[model samples]
Target: MIETLTRIPVAHYSNLKARAGYSIKIDKTEIALFKVTNGEVYALENRSPHPKGGVLSEGLVSGNYVYCPVYDWKISLVDGTVQAPDEGKVQTYQVEIKENIIFIVL
Candidate 1:
């Protein structure tokens, strides 16, 4: 259910560095959007699941996971799932890019 995305526009797509995340502030929420691969875009909570650590925008992207810099915890960017062993999860959003603009669904 795309409840928050107002419109699907060509987002300002940029060539993100390897293992890095990007953020955009929308509706007062410091949202984090990630492009892990050339063909994949994943959006997750800007805040870490553990403690009050802020998942830096420039995070390491591995496959479908993003490693949190605060604690080195691996988080699944696709579904906000903890990698393994760790029992923590973060909020994830849906990313849709049309033409080039990214429309994130909350």
Candidate 2:
């Protein structure tokens, strides 16, 4: 089966800085956008799976992982999987880049 996705333009590439994350709201859902040090962009649900806080956008990003600020749970930005020694996961969104504009699929 083929999956169809709605693409929503979020931001420009220049607006996102390396090692920084931006919080974007799509309808009623909150999404976290990250531009890793290597210029890779990722989109994930803005909530941490640890149930402590919804500050994944402000979490510390290391490589492809973001460490939750409340409990220090490391989450993979690529797949939204909780790192080893922890369990739980966040939702990841597909990202598209066109003409330096960033879009997230819902």
lDDT of 1 by residue, 1-106 (tens): 6555455332466654445788777767766777765667777778778776756465677887887787878888888877777768887877777666778764
lDDT by residue for model 2 (1-106), tens = 9988899999998899887779999999999999999999999999999857658999998999998878899999989999889999999999999999999977
Model 1: lDDT of residue 27: 68
Native-referenced Cα lDDT, model 1: 0.72
- My TM-score estimates for the predictions, one after another, are 0.81, 0.93
Badly placed stretches (over 4 Å) of model 1 are: 1-5, 8-10, 15-18
Worst 10 residues of 1 by lDDT: 2-11
Per-residue lDDT value at 55 in model 2: 87
